[model samples]
Target: MLSELQKETAKAIVNIFETGSARGDYARVTLLTGDSGHLTYGRAQTTLGSGNLHLLIKAYCATPGAAYARTLKPYLPQLADIDLRLDTDWSFRNVLKEAGGDPVMRDVQDDFFDRVYWTPALASAKRTGLGEALSAAVVYDSVVHGSWIAMRDRTTAKAGAASSAGERRWIGVYLDTRRDWLASHSNALLRKTVYRMDAFKALAASGNWSLDLPMMVRGVRIDPDALCLRPPVNASAIEVATRNLRLTDPKMSGNDVRALEEALSKEGYAINRDGIFDEGLETALKSFQRDFGLVDDGIAGPATRLMLGI
Candidate 1:
């Protein structure tokens, strides 16, 4: 059984990657060809590849006992042999999103994640004698970013042996090694995402090895005791009138501009609703994107719109 702290920590960190605190399964496409010659997609991040969705579909069909499993059974075979090589095909992507993003299916997916990923981490943590909360947080984050074995390998290489060092020292070594991996990776995306390591480093630096105290991950303060399942106010309803908005389009003035201002203001960015997409708005938008782990391109394109849940 997963502890409350473990579950909450996992949810909080995943929220940073999935929707940037915008709760609800917002499906986004991330295409990659795996070593097994299969294309991976959706929110598996880099670890499970496209196999994540494939596994989810399989698990759902196998467990007809689940109240919601039967509803998704008929659609199983069609998705059973998904070839993500053609991930761009609307039929494929739509079906994938519907199944993967269904709110009812989340509990099923969570169970899958816990079984496949979190449980193993707990076992490893127990062997290392790590505190429950800290171990879960470290291992859960690693599963999303890559794999626990890789993390363990690095920890072993850096800190000599887990038996030789204290829990705090071992965690510090693991985090430092993770930072190095993220920084020197061949993939540009991996290298650029070192901020995750920085967040872990912050926890270590504060000596919060137990992770029971208040913590901050990626500029967002997390109060574990007062943690609410709901996201920040209006996170799901983040939308702006972009019918005629663009960079440096002299006519940045419109209802769209006013709408954007209101949205940004709700996010705590003070802006005059003067119907102009001025430098101020652009700066605030970039800041928001940074906080949410979105690309800081300062352009409100489809990706940005999706991140804002528009």
Candidate 2:
């Protein structure tokens, strides 16, 4: 199971990555390059290779260790179900002894952790007052949510679907996020263990790996840079959305009457394909917004369209 510390680390670190970039990580080299990519690869080939080392490296190089656990006091219980045996006291010495002679592991250790230690927990503590809101997020009892995310990322990446970005169909998104690495070891046990050790170092450095869905640390085969981001989240101005929607049907926004008629059609109360939004449309819009968990304003804003999944 993921130790309590792992959950804290994962939440804090992922919070930074999510809110921080909308889609990216932290740190200098890799992060500086971009969230949608890696460093040496970008500089050299402008491409993320399909290699396990690169994937693990990418995760570590993006955030700080200290920051990983700094923001997760609320949801630490979710790490309970993960049966991670990596950091158990018994394996502590074994890992170190194993890495004792590996120069590459030793060399990257400090670089990996330095990034982890300095990154702030990124609770959006000061930005949106979400720091306090984050404090209230559900606290589940599971193991390795952090590690699970990491492993899941690997699975998703390996599927090469992330490269499609927002262009991916819903199935693409679902499949990429779900992957299994255990049955697909594809390599000798020693090599697998070595690669896993590297992943652990990266995980430990990020300080957030979840044991819950632990397969992520095994490795990734993603061909990143293959995808682009989804269209800017439906955050475009509501007026813009309204204008566009009105344009689609035209007769909808001529006046309050036409607009209301169109609005009613949009709200599914009446299907006046004739595009005039009338007062009835306003009433319908209000009801539609309420049902969709949006602000109950009669204005046809971006929120409405998104909820409708248009």
Candidate 3:
């Protein structure tokens, strides 16, 4: 069994990958193009497309003292149906974002993601004879990212079982194999996500098999302070709320627009990442909005950004 700090550190690594915060952003809602799991939300960004999002919200609504229980109860059916329209519903999205700030919602997400992701990941790690905390983390990331089984099998096939090849070597092979797969994937969005594997590879290379504290992940420090709810060094709260990307007469262009274009392309939209919010980008955004049942206003406001996972 892993120690508490090890577990939290492992989780913190993925939390940074998910929400850019070591403590996680419970209110984070993400929708990416071409992602099978659409409308991902909460601390771990559970996806609606996988029906796990329905399970998560149901658990929340059933819990006592849930701030949005009554308000969210009415939308259970749509959630159960994996309704893509919920992606664009401003009021519903607002409620979810607001509810995320509730203590009860945070507790529910902690419990839910633990039960749904962590527990299974641990089991998979134990089954593979991998006991190192970093190994557990690599497995956990695969589980959260989806297709743990496929990757596990692929790794075993290529490099032998973890028990046979040794845990460290097996994990190294897995990371390299997974990185190659992500880099060569037909989906452009998945290709951009090789950073996940790269981060894991960095941890492995550092001999952090024990997952000691004071580690740097994707430039964010994960130390005692960060795990205790303090912000990481050199990291500020992601201003996802105030960001607004839209088409203008002169065509707005910047890193934000470039990020949006990347996210849009990941969603399978045909758009170039020219860092310009031109009419073409707006048209693509509208198409994405229409596909997800959001308003086709061609605006990448809070609601739209939440959907785009940008």
Candidate 4:
């Protein structure tokens, strides 16, 4: 099972790619504020309600004992104590008289924006240019928080008994050979089950789990709408997991084959989509997974699906 963080990371990357399509500019904002510092949306002259630099704090919290824990530290030096007071004007008038323009804020804005616009959605997608780090920051929140889930069916819905007095009939000795369904599982298995508990509850009780957005502005339309994390189906931008050569069968036709070929090529697997996975095709698919440091299983599973970027 993948971590919520991992899924969020993927979702964020996807969103940035999608935003670039609609807005022509998907910015990466690196708040030059402290952990508990307040983040507000204020125009050059207007003011907005304060929002705790909650996203940043959540990022740090997600990674418990990371060496480079605070994501904003590299950008906001001389980090002040976490003060979540909203509506306090950034005294630029006094700031200008005391010291020149804010070097930190300027630096953060320049770097963050540059990164978001420059970084390719895929890991190491750059070819012949400077790379961006903050682009990774835009999707930062989506890939971290827990998503709601629930059980699709109820357990122990039926009980069996003989007049409430269960009796065992004489039977031959029965030897068990099956192993426990969850015995000796990896630690990740347990963590994933625990992580999705909230979603499980929501599904068990209701049917949907919603993400708690960091408050949205009233009566105003925010680009990349604050509500939806996933991209719209009609989004112009498409995700390509990787860039490499791909192959297709001579028998395959038109756009269907074309789309599959492109998707697979992005995953570094080139195969002719001649409506069949022949011997050569199977070998190629397995080799592609191997090259990606994936489980080289012949079957194409979730990881491979992700690689296909669908």
Candidate 5:
């Protein structure tokens, strides 16, 4: 049976990829293309080239005799015919957003992640004799971001050493290999997103193979068994308390930074939407603070969060 920790590890991976943190299914529009070389959105990190658009349409069509699905049925051919890369167009995005509102998109995401990613990952973990929470988490992420065949091939190639060294050591080996693969990938965008590998390395370094202790991913500390409610659909911003947030703090990451950066950008402050609350982000935060009559302390506490509405 899958343990609760293992399940949360899956959710946590999704959190890191989709929202930067473990609280919500925040909508993100980072760029036409970024480090991942894919247009990304929602909790599942659905990318344009990854057949997710096709999956969404199929998912919508799967609903039996629903008007919404039927309304979109006519456009299925158009959706299918359009090049995934051309989805960068504003018109295409608007149509996609309309067709796949939050509820349907969540459904599609759950379906794809469960069927296409997590199920295979879980099965592969069993094959590899992996039972640790962190190991399962890593496998799931590999399946989601890369593919089962590639990860399996790599694992098999490294199996001799991993078998001798045990599961923990195998995880380290696998992560190192994955990092190298990403760094040397043909796609420059994929190559630049090696931070995902770095994050996993950090998790392994902490010796929490079972993921029983708190650890960081994408600068956010993930406490074992920590539970967070998914935010409502189309939520403009997330509410935060004074606790668990600070400039350069590991806890202050994920959607919080994305939200802050987006808000600042709207008000004419330039910042990267990488989701890390670095010094540049701190400076931008202070600029926003000074303008909004809040303390320019640069810590994203309750007051600052409220002022930014994120």
Candidate 6:
């Protein structure tokens, strides 16, 4: 089994490829034209066209203390149906973007991606007798990016099974085959993603089978610090504005809630900036809503969040 750090390094490599960040962009949303995976979102960019986006969002909505659950719950039907119209729905897209900043949403995504992609990738690696961390990373990428089975079969047919041809050699052949397939794919968008394979080829060439840290991927640095889960160093105003804060059974808690409390305190409300949205924060929020002529529901939806400037 790969050590925890090696697994993290492997994941960070793909995270950089997927979202341009080693830690992954929890709030990143991409909709590339001619892309088979429509309306990609969160860490690994689960695709709406593949119905995984629905699964990711559904998982988030079910989690308690999810800041945007109420706002996002309404769109579950459209997501489940794989409604392509959602590709252009700016409102839904904005909500998804904002939800990315929520800690609950981030946790849900880590778990969901691991369950849906990482676990299977590891199993595939073990079955092929491929124990190298880099090998696992390549398989994980194919699983997340799609068509692993077809490409794995093609590579086996061309170069023989990894068990017989040897793991490293088989992986090299697999990468070459996958690179060719991506370059010649009918989907123009997919053709552009051959860079992923190119990056892997470079890594294999360097003999970095262990996925050592301090690696550079697509111009992003994947260092020890970059792999740690933390808030973005410089968050955009829109990301901050999109967080839907509210009280929950366990009490929503995060920097977003702390920002809301600080804003309320600035406006002459007595509240603590402890990052926990408890009853005290809710009561203060209700008072602020009443004073601002908004609904006094205490749920910090867009209106309340906007009013508080959080």
lDDT of model 6, residue 285: 94
How many steric overlaps does candidate 1 have? 1
Candidates, ranked, TM-score:
3, 6, 5, 1, 2, 4
lDDT of each: 0.54, 0.29, 0.77, 0.28, 0.58, 0.78
Candidate 1, superposed: residue stretches over 4 Å from native: 22-29, 32-50, 63-82, 223-310
Which parts of model 4 have CA positions greater than 4 angstroms off?
1-130, 139-258, 262-270, 299-310
| Model 6 agreement with the true structure over 204-247: per-residue lDDT tens digits | 99999888877877777687566433322111111011334667
Alpha-carbon RMSD, candidate 6: 17.2
**Best-matching candidate per lDDT:** 6
Give the per-residue lDDT digits (tens) of candidate 1, residues 1-310. Answer: 4567656665566555443441324354344322221333333322122234545555666654554455556644434334444445566556556656665456666665555445555655666656646656776666544545666777887787666777777877887887787678555556655676676777767766566535666545566333334322111101111232344746467776777777778778877779888888888888876875544646553334433433
lDDT by residue for model 4 over 1-310, one digit each (tens)?
2234433433333333333221212122212222111232110100111111222222233444533334334422211222333224344222222221333333332332222221222232221110222212212211111110001001111212211222110000000000111122232232222212222222223321222222211211223453443322111111111111223334324553355455666666667666454555557767866776554544343234434443
Deviation (Å) of 165 in candidate 4:
77
lDDT tens digits by residue: candidate 2, 224-297: 22122321110000011023232223334555345545545665775454545545555666777677454464
Q: Which candidate do you rate higher for TM-score, 4 or 5?
A: 5
Clash tally, candidates in order: 1, 47, 3, 15, 1, 0
Off by over 4 Å in 2: 1-15, 18-268
Question: 3 or 4: which has the higher lDDT?
Answer: 3
* TM-scores for the candidates: 0.59, 0.25, 0.72, 0.23, 0.61, 0.72
Candidate 4 scores a C-alpha RMSD against the true structure in Å of 21.0
Q: How far out, in Å, is residue 179 in model 2?
A: 14
Q: How close is candidate 3 to the true structure, as a TM-score?
A: 0.72
- Candidate 3 accuracy as lDDT: 0.77
- Model 1 compared with the native: what TM-score? 0.59
lDDT of 2 at 57: 37
